[model samples]
Target: MAEKASIKCPSCGTEVEKPKKTWPLIGRPARDGSRIKLMIGQFECPRCGRKFKVAVKKERIPPEGR
Candidate 1:
């Protein structure tokens, strides 16, 4: 299940939007060696204009019509 990642601005304390980019989780790799198993997200606060990064857990979605 893909849960919503709560991104809050540290300076203004406002909830930020979802991250635009995601990278593979540190030290953890997918078994396939190509798929992304665990990952983190990078977000920028729109309210304070501050760039921040947070660890986010996301599940991979399978393609439709299996």
Candidate 2:
């Protein structure tokens, strides 16, 4: 199973749902040269009307039932 990602609004402390759109980060080199990638998501707070960007690291994990 995949874990659900969530973020809290800094202005109002309200929990915001995961972003509907996500874009992969490119052209960045890792120190260890790992195959991991970073994803950036933009979201706006419904209550406070504030916009922010959230960075999420992408990784591969085995399924829970395995």
Best by lDDT: 2
Q: State in Å the error of residue 10, model 1.
A: 1.7
Relative to the true structure, how large is the alpha-carbon lDDT of every model? 0.69, 0.70
Off by over 4 Å in 2: 60-66
Model 2 weakest 10-residue run by lDDT = 57-66
- TM per candidate: 0.59, 0.66
Backbone clashes for every candidate come to: 0, 0
Question: Could you tell me the lDDT of residue 62 within candidate 2?
Answer: 31
* Top candidate by TM-score: 2
Deviating ranges (above 4 Å) for candidate 1: 28-38, 58-66
Give the alpha carbon lDDT tens digit for every residue of 4-27 in model 1. Answer: 767797788889878868787644
